[model samples]
Target chain A: MREVFHQSLEDVQSRLVEIAELVTVAIERATKAFGTSDVTLAEEVIEADQVIDDKAIELDELAIQILARQQPVARDLRIVVAALRVSASLERMGDIAEHIAQLTRMRFPERAIPKGLKSTFTKMGEIDVQVANLLTEILRTEDLALVEKLRTLDDQLDDLHLSVFEKVLSENWQGEAGATVDATLASRYHERFADHALSVAKKVAYLATGEWTPDTDSIAVIVAADLAAVRENADGAEA
Target chain B: MREVFHQSLEDVQSRLVEIAELVTVAIERATKAFGTSDVTLAEEVIEADQVIDDKAIELDELAIQILARQQPVARDLRIVVAALRVSASLERMGDIAEHIAQLTRMRFPERAIPKGLKSTFTKMGEIDVQVANLLTEILRTEDLALVEKLRTLDDQLDDLHLSVFEKVLSENWQGEAGATVDATLASRYHERFADHALSVAKKVAYLATGEWTPDTDSIAVIVAADLAAVRENADGAEA
Candidate 1:
């Protein structure tokens, strides 16, 4: 029975890693589509979402089965629960990537985004890659120190988001409607991507600390930067 | 040990319901402030958030302890895991309410929002109350049906958010800057509140189905409505 339980646990972990890998690929493909306006790549990202979704369901079932069979206690139980939460976060990340891909498909063929905003999208893609890397590290080592590093990375994403907004609202760009739409969508995708990354970090923190911390400082900093960016943009418009 | 686990579970449930109550109150207060431009009421919502945050952490720890001690299997394990996710969603709801209150404070003394948007805000408040009630039912009965009902109510909130944006971008609203700020913040708060409600519903679904189905049709509907509203508003402005 113990051997069976151990085997099931390992199976669930491996499946989770597989789902994470799919999510990373989805992010990469979605961002590539965004940068190149490749509708075919976007379609691929959308089509591949089912695999991630199915794997997430498989992991949940495995976790439930392990709990029912082994009745894991203490640390073992925490590990199972953490795996469930992390899987959900990863699933959400996949969903966000699909969302970005869908937006790309909708706004394509027109080259709606200007050159300036392309760099913003590129920045977002970089952040998405960082988030994917963080998930890999957490799964590989379950190390809290590596998870702690997500805070600074999340802050950088926030800064890039604010800068994107500032550039969108400025007169140098003629405030084109297409530009605004691209900027808004790009900002939202980055913000939400960072949010999922933070969710993963929170799960890792729980594994390490045995307690859940809200980590509001990161959000506060984002909000503060948002307010400052809006103010600066408004002033620039007035001038 | 079983008795202790049961008691802790009960404690966590009670606190969850309490937090739900606070979320409803904060939503009500923030909406009222939006209607009347009452800074004092908004301030109350902001101040009350600390209590919500504290309870969230406390309940999270209690749930973890219960899991560690009881090593609950199957349904029991699902219930504990659901509780943890629900608490996180509730905490996020509290944060959204506080965010709206902050917006109210920022727009004070001059009434940034016009009278035309009051009905829409009131409708959003109604949806908020419904979501809170749905969560309370979830805790009381663990009824999957009632939780499913929340998905529709979330759509209603999204509809209300669309109308708010329509009013903002319409020519009838000559004061573009303040209206834009008010509408942006209002839409964000409403959308986020609905998102949290959906998160709670997802937890209930997992508890019932043992599968992460990611039923987001309701959100898709809401997003479609937003796109239509934005288009109509822009067209009307051009006319």
Candidate 2:
């Protein structure tokens, strides 16, 4: 029974890594699509999201079955429970990618990157793809060091996200309402993609570190802080 | 052992209800604060979110303990697992409220609700509060009927969300980039609050109804469809 349970735990881990890989691909393609107005590539990301969703559901079922049959206790139980959460977060990351793709498709033949903020969004997308890759590595290897790297990447994404707002809200900005809206939503999607990856990285870190922290440092705090800092800077600039 | 396990499950249920009640209050205050630009009320919501977070963590610990001790299987195990997911969604609902409060506070001395969209945001806020209340009721009573009502309210919120985008993207929109950003983020927050409640409501409904669906009809699909429909209408207007 002990050996069987260990094997099941391995299964959960591999499956998580698998789903993370799929999310990585989804974000990579979605970001590329958004940058180039490649509607075909965007459509691929939109369609492939279902596979990620299906894999997450399968993983969840496996976790539930392990609980029902193996009845893992103590740390083993926490591992299974955390798999459920990691699966949920990975699934959300896929959805964020799909949302970015949808944004690309919605503005097909018209650049979704907006007129003046193209380079800003391009950087955000590249960072998001990097974050997804790092997340997959963490899930696969359980390298806790990657967790810090992931957080740093997420912070960079947050700064770029802020820069987006700064660009749009500046007096010299000349984009129309559609451009502003696209930039706002697209920047948000890119930032949230990294945020979810960071969250999953934290969970993996907890599993490796045995800290059992329950997401006290949530995305809301980071978002609020980012916004507050940007607003203060904007105020200072005007002064 | 059986009796103790049953008792533990009841404790989980009641604790879920308790957390849901707190979420209801958070959203109620948050939406109110947003509409009024009441910085103090926003501060109250922000400060109280930590309590909600702490409760969620406590609930998670309890659930983990139940899994460790009771080792429930089949439907019983799924119940505890569902509690964890529901707790997460409720906690996220609280975070969304905090986000709205942050927006309110961020724009203090200047109204957060952009001009000409006051009535729309008011309706969205009211529906979000209603969704939170119904979600709490569903958690408390397992009343599947309320789930339908919750979906209806979510639909209303979705329409309002799309309408905000429409108004912002239209030719007549006169709000500056700051107002546009605020409206975009605030509307997204309001819409997501309801979405989280609807998600929790679905899990409760599944538990009560014995259907094992695993979020196949995700928020991604709904959002994609919403954006598609709105863009179609916008394109038609241009044509």
Candidate 3:
């Protein structure tokens, strides 16, 4: 029974990595479509998002079953709970990718990205795909080494997102209100996509580190989580 | 032991409703400050957000303890899981409200919203507060009758959100990129706030009904949830 439980746990982990791969492909295709106004690629990305959704649902049920069967405690329990969260995050990442694709499909032929900002979008798209790749890698290997790199990537995206804003709101800007809106929303999508990737990595970090974050900043969150865990253990003993 | 478990479960449920109420007040003050350009109120909302965060973390730890201790299955497990999701959604709702207030803070004394859309935003704000109130009520009463009201409220917010986009994109628009971006993001915050409330409602409905939703459109999601639950049950029995 113990071996079986671990097998099911392994299955859940692999399923999460699989979903991360699909999410990576979705973001890659969706961003490629965004940069080139490739409506066909955009359509494909949109249609394929259903697969990610189905995988998430399947992974969720598997995790729930494991919980019911083993009633795991401590790190094992955290791992299963984190699996559910990672699946949801990946599913949301896919949905965001689909939304980006929809934006591409909406402006098809006309180009969702304007001419002046194409290179910027190109940069953002490249960085976003890289972030997505990092997500897949980290999920696959559970490597803490890759965790710090995601924050750097997310910081890069934030800088790029802000630059997009500055360019649009610059004194010499000539784009219409519509283009400005498009640029703003699209930049936000890519930035948030990176944010979600970073979020998943943080969850994995917590799982590996055996901590529960009580806040956003890593140091403070870890310290607070440790305090909370100690307090909870005392409470549990008392109860 | 059963009595202790039931007591703990009730404690978890009440904590969730408490978080919901805090979310309610946060949205109310944030939107109120947005309309009036009341920077003080906006600042208050922003500062008060940490309390919501602390409460959510507290609620989550409590739920995790219940799960680890009780090892609940079926409906009881669903309720605990739903509480976690609800706390998350409420926390997110608070964050969005904080974003709205931060916008007000960023554009203080200048009124982040334009005069033309004031009435529209006013209407939207009223509905958002109503939606927030409904969230508090449903979390408290678990009254499925209020469930229908949330969909209606969400539709209202959606309609208002669309109108904001339409007005900004219309030919008469004179606002610069800054105001346009502000309008776009602020409207989205409100729309998403309502969206989260509706989501918590759907989760509660599933808990009440023992369904497993595949998506967010309540009726269709509920139907799909039912089918998924049936399939999962068959899979469990077969296993």
lDDT by residue for model 3 (A30-126), tens: 9999988899999898889899999998888887788787888777887887787788789888988887887787665678896589888899889
CAPRI quality level assigned to candidate 1 from its DockQ score: acceptable
Please tell me which model should have the higher DockQ, number 2 or number 3: 2
Show pairs that collide, candidate 3.
none
Candidate 2 chain A: worst-modelled 10 consecutive residues by lDDT = A212-221
Model 2 misplaced regions, further than 4 Å: A217-239, B214-239
TM-score (C-alpha, index-matched) for candidate 2: 0.96
Tell me how far the alpha carbon of residue B165 in candidate 3 is from the true structure, in angstroms, after superposition.
1.1
lDDT per residue (tens digit) for residues A31-56 in model 2: 99999999999999999999999999
Interface CA RMSD, all predictions: 3.7, 2.1, 10.7
**CAPRI class of candidate 3:** incorrect
In model 1 chain B, the worst 10-residue window by lDDT is B173-182
- Model 1 ranges with Cα > 4 A deviation: A1-6, A112-115, A143-145, A171-173, A176-182, A205-213, A225-239, B1-8, B37-40, B105-118, B141-152, B164-185, B202-214, B225-239
Models ranked on lDDT: 2, 3, 1
1 or 2, greater by TM-score: 2
lDDT (Cα, tens digit) per residue for candidate 2, span B3-103: 99999999999999999999989999999999998999999999999999999999999999999888898789989999999999998889899989988
lDDT of each: 0.73, 0.87, 0.80
Which is the leading candidate under lDDT? 2
